[model samples]
Target: MPEKEITRISKFLSLVLRHQPEKINITLDENGWTDVATLIQQVNKSGSRLSFEILDFVVANNNKKRFAFNPDKTKIRAHQGHSVEIKLGYPPQTPPAVLYHGTSEKNLASILAEGIQKRNRHQVHLSPDKSTALTVGQRHGKPVILQVDAAAMHAAGLVFYLSENQVWLTGLVHAEFLHVLTT
Candidate 1:
């Protein structure tokens, strides 16, 4: 498939798989997985041409590795960033001493005042390093990276999980645990 087609399909998949499987009348399993064949059928039924090969291409070529296939290639799901309720089932693990979150400078004040909230998503997403966080921030404009004190939070009885794409997940990061990272 062409690059534009790939991106279009990727975005569509993200929309359906992560937020609204009901849009295509498909259902995700308890752990957020859905049948791959059923997904292709529904996607095509919705007037988007999709095939297992194209799906594989999008999964393999997406820069963030947004989706994954089960070991048997029979199931698939977004790694995280779900709006509708579905458990990802990633086990809790100790994060690095620090993790990074990037956002527009415009949002910094609110973030610093309230810490980071999950908002519409399931969990606050954190990056393992500044560069990735920066890229994420740039999307929102006037990028600003915030350093999170993961160690302190963990010590304070908070839990963290690393998604398949290496994005960090946490229920919350209180304002006290954040520091504006100066580049």
Candidate 2:
């Protein structure tokens, strides 16, 4: 596949699967899976061409590993980062001792005062490593990394989930659990 085609389809898939299934006239089940056949047909109807082969390629090759297929490959769902209301139903897990969050420096003041909020996303995303967090932050501009004391947060009873893609998911990270990671 041409790089352009793959990139286009990957982005479109991310958009629909994570944020707007309605854009393609499909709805995800409560657990976020959508029938693969139906999703492909819907994509075609929406003026985009999709096939199981292409879908498989995107799921396997996406840098973030953002989508997943069911065991039989009959269904699919975004690994996380859903803004649309849907229960991913990922079971809670104990997070690592530390996690990292990346954001633009412009948001530092609010984050320092109030802590990180999910904003429009369903949950605040944390990376297991600083390098991944840095990449995420760079998207927003002058990257700022926040080191999260995950062990402390877990001890304090904050729940955490590990997405299939390995991102950490939590409702919030209070300022007390956060430290600005200085280079």
Cα error, residue 42 of model 1, in Å, equals 0.8
Clashing pairs in 1: none
Cα TM-score per model: 0.97, 0.96
Candidate 1 segments exceeding 4 Å error: none
Instruction: State the local distance difference test value for candidate 2.
Output: 0.92
- How good is model 2 by TM-score? 0.96
For all candidates in order, the CA lDDT equals: 0.94, 0.92
Which structure among the candidates has the greatest TM-score? 1
Per residue, candidate 1 scores C-alpha lDDT tens digits across 84-138 of 8999999999999999999999999999999999999999999999999999999
- lDDT computed for candidate 1: 0.94
